[model samples]
Target chain A: MTWNSWFSHGAPTAGFTGGPSIVSRNNAVCNIYVRGGDNALWQKAFFNGAWHPWGRHNDGAVLASEPALGSMGPNHEHIFVRGTDGAVWSKAWNGAGGWSGWFSHAAPVAGLTGGPAIVSRNNTVCNIYVRGGDNALWQRAFFNGSWHPWGRHNDGAVLASEPALGSMGANHEHVFVRGTDGAVWSKAWNGAGGWSGWFSHGAPAGGMIGGPTIVSRNSGVCNIYVRGTDNALWQKAYFDGSWHAWGRHDDGAVLASEPALGSMGPSHEHVFVRGTDSAVWSKAWSLVPTVILHLKVLTNPTSFTVDQMVASMRDVYASRGINVAVGSRETLDLPLLTDVDVSTCIMGTTTAEQNQLFANRNGVGANHVVAYFVRSTNPPGNGCAAHPAGRPGCVVSSTSSSWTLGHEIGHVLGLPHVSPSDRLMMGNGTWNITNPPPDLIDTERATMDTSPLTVNI
Target chain B: MPVTMRDVRAVLDPDEVDYSAGARLGPEAFDYLLALVRDTDPGLAAKAAYLAGVIRGERSEEVVAAAAASEDALVRVAAASAAALLAPASASRVLNDLVVDQDSGVQKLALRSVPADPSPELRSRVREVSAGAAEPGLRAMADNVLRGLH
Candidate 1:
């Protein structure tokens, strides 16, 4: 069976409860931890290119709720589980060695209502937040290989469930919880200054029963997801220095528990939940509503103008969920530029070498797509998404039609060629530039949306 | 999560993948290979099976056996090929079963996997298929395996 069936058949969630937690070290490695029917902490890891069988981590200790996971070192992973004894127990795993036996973090004034929210920074410090017996928020941290004593951050608002945590930058962190009044309330920690007063996010989630799941897309933006009173998934993001109004994903499923979210890359977030059908359902969001491509023309053949090339691609890609615009343009002086030179410079080069060249010649900022186009009559396959350009960037043909331009850019945006002929990434390397016909497929859209450089047009 | 087509495509390049690297990766790599053989993507499953054969140790052969019985012909062919490359004699039973597969492509690959002087069962099966198989390619492959038996 193809993995496509796994999406419909779902991950093996035969007897899972509470919210699932997912974390990743990179796009290629991720782990999902959940409470098993036996009330033990079970996790499935995605390593290399496939999901490993689910393994129990708590050494048969029955957990009272779900498990929260974080990494304290590049090779070290920690899973904090609330044991049936009401004390939070922890287990450590090293990439070099396997798992260490569960250790206790002592109780935090009282037992936890559910699992705590866990996050790690620079593999040096880890913070855990849980709801205390007093229905107030409590916190603890791990630093210098030791567990810090529990501290209270009582935000006056009565808490009913777990508190979610997200870090905006090196030292800035945000903790969000559902107040007794059903409003989403948050307080932040500025590593240099300490905790701040509870700020009401003002989103009424009146019937939210569990903690919210939060993830930062980058240092500048973060998103929060919660199950509304209507049992629908709702989201709100903090972007451009302010919080946006809450919006519904209209996910079209009744969630059985609080959602779990993690970013696969910048501008790409995936939300997971246990559906009423007892299956895991995941939805992906690509926050990049548009993208700017910086074109550095080594030389354009007299046959076609760069503007014509841009207009052709813009006309084709605009309808397929990406707005293409030029953020900057420049031309370079060379003694003699030839098609063979362009091909040799790109195809024969390594990504590091290409990146070095771009770094020396272009001042394009991070999160900006940059490409070097040449007036080549014989570019690699008429165009190429040469990885050496480095920054979600590439090298392409200046003479190719808008279709080829769009196809190469698609590669820049993390798309791969598909077998079908009707799509933009047709296997035969042909595309319909005139009609373009929504050539971008669903997988391509999802991949593009998750691009770290994807942004509003 | 199931492996995606994109994931399968990522490792298709022979130059990009180090076939022996998985064996050196310890348990985590072994777990990955185990899951990959059962992947829904037949191409990925086939490739992983081939890699498992190259990495030959512990549960690698077990993974190849499971993949050899997969419903997808491509996966079964890959498993057969891997089995031939690794423990050909141990793969004799699987090759015997595949030598008569309904899919001619599977039959050809399975016949090609027969070890020198393979089990009588595999040799007899290959003989039968070579005599009656409709596809010339399968017939040729079966005859080739029969030559080795002789």
Candidate 2:
């Protein structure tokens, strides 16, 4: 629940001038780089349980600010820095080979204020951005084994601070910068669509200080965190086709540095910033619970189709903050099996003699909840769907509501009947679609989120 | 000293026993473990049956087979998984019954445990379930087993 801290040799002896940049290679090793007190780049390596001593890599160039870091391939890393000459310098570190001495780009940057923002689309191409002398953005890229000449992204807005970079997919990458107006403006590059004009994602309520930091949860969702006008931390997310309103998360602590974002796990985002106390601080944001349910039709249904049921179920659970993924439906050979107790419906088969009829079946994942929808129940009240606690699947009647599916599956997912008996888990053969029961309690939410079959996020 | 029912009970308590010591347990442990397959605590009985397979041998196989046939769903599920570790031909019959178990847990474990080289009879059973089982969970599992078997 707490971030583990490691103090490498040559840690910032002076206050960190700009945000330190770190990137993981092959997700197995993380290389961290910072501007040491002497104002040059110093780096350390973390891999296979041991940290290599900090080593300086800058080639006698006086760095004006922090360096940007990105990965090119398995164990390959690239670092970009703004030099005292106002020129952008670059270096590469290969796990197999050694360091590529700092090389100056063909064109010296005009204004070159802060560290450049750099990102790579896997091992194919790397893009770097820096503010130019005119206060506009300049960009260059490395592709097909060569560096392209720097060009202007001059979208008519002047940048006042450093830039942050993030890649949402193979073909998409975005750059965020603090505008002269203290607002955050973004311009994106789509592999097929080229560059887009700069757009505003809103700025801090107070004003902006340093650059913004961006991280992608997946190919479609990206979040940006920045220091607000009031020195508080603010965040906005680009998800589900539109940008979300900015949300504040300063927790009343003023920040002294730009934020850095990364994912510790699927759906888990951590934003790191420097508090006014000079100590590093982190806040984590987690996505909602996502689960997949596999339905097996054991009998022909007369009322509703399988897709209709799945859609209804998704809508019902989505309202409760749960993301439901219904797997493909498979038609089984027999009707739902009934137990000697008419109240309980058997899931797979009632007799051992029935085992031989189902050996070659496949497609069920370990985390999948298997539900068998049978025709009519013996005495059909709300139908007889039953499931044991902590099981992977359950049995439900075809005539049951989507709420019934949620209830029975909730039981398989480890939620017991709600004690008040007025909720969705209430087992009185009745449900209120419009009012429904309250959302799953915290403990139940945790159980559902941690279930092995659920998606990691 | 020979392992006793006390030792078996101790091992079944997750808090008290070291499960990783399953291989180090001696032959005497099997008899006691077999008796615990029907222990009053279904969870304990399930753990006992599973350990029987982990300490696998002549006696472990017998316990696994017997536990597979037990009426207790927990025991049956454990037995189904344990039986899969034994000689497929000898344990195939027990696995056949478990694959279609009324309990989803038992059915899942049984379907998962069916051997890659199951006997022809077991293969036939798997095919039947793959195509006819009322629950897609088992059917999906059956389909996976059939893919591997063929």
Chain B TM-scores across candidates = 0.80, 0.89
Q: Score candidate 1 by lDDT.
A: 0.67
DockQ of each: 0.01, 0.02
Encode model 2's per-residue lDDT on B9-76: one tens digit a residue: 55553211234465467567887877777656444566677777777677877788778878766467
State the lDDT of candidate 2 residue by residue for A110-225, as single tens digits: 65665677888668898888777677888888888888988887568788876788888788888888777777888888978988888887775676667678988578788888
Please report the candidate that would top DockQ against the real structure.
Answer: 2
Query: Which parts of model 2 have CA positions greater than 4 angstroms off?
Result: A1-15, A49-61, A106-109, A250-254, A263-269, A280-455, B1-150
Docking class of 1: incorrect
* Candidate 1: stretches off by over 4 Å: A1-14, A204-209, A286-457, B1-150
lDDT by residue for model 1 (A1-457), tens: 0011113214444477766777776766678888887776777877888768777754777887678877655467778888778888888888778888888877787666766678775567888888888878888887888779998865475786688888877788888887776777888888778888887665534556566778886888888888887788888888899899888755466777788887656766677787777666666666436678787776563335777667766765666656777889887643122121222223325443354435534677778877666433111224556555345666554334446666667777777766565677764444222344536766787788788767763
Tell me which residue pairs clash in candidate 1: A1-B40, A2-B40, A2-B41, A3-B40, A3-B41, A351-A388
What TM-score would every model get versus the actual structure?
0.50, 0.49
For candidate 1, give the lDDT of residue A138: 83
Candidate 1 lDDT, B1-150, residue by residue in tens:
454444333343221133443344433344566677787855456657766676666666777788888997657766766777656567786687888888654665567678886888888898898899887756776777777674
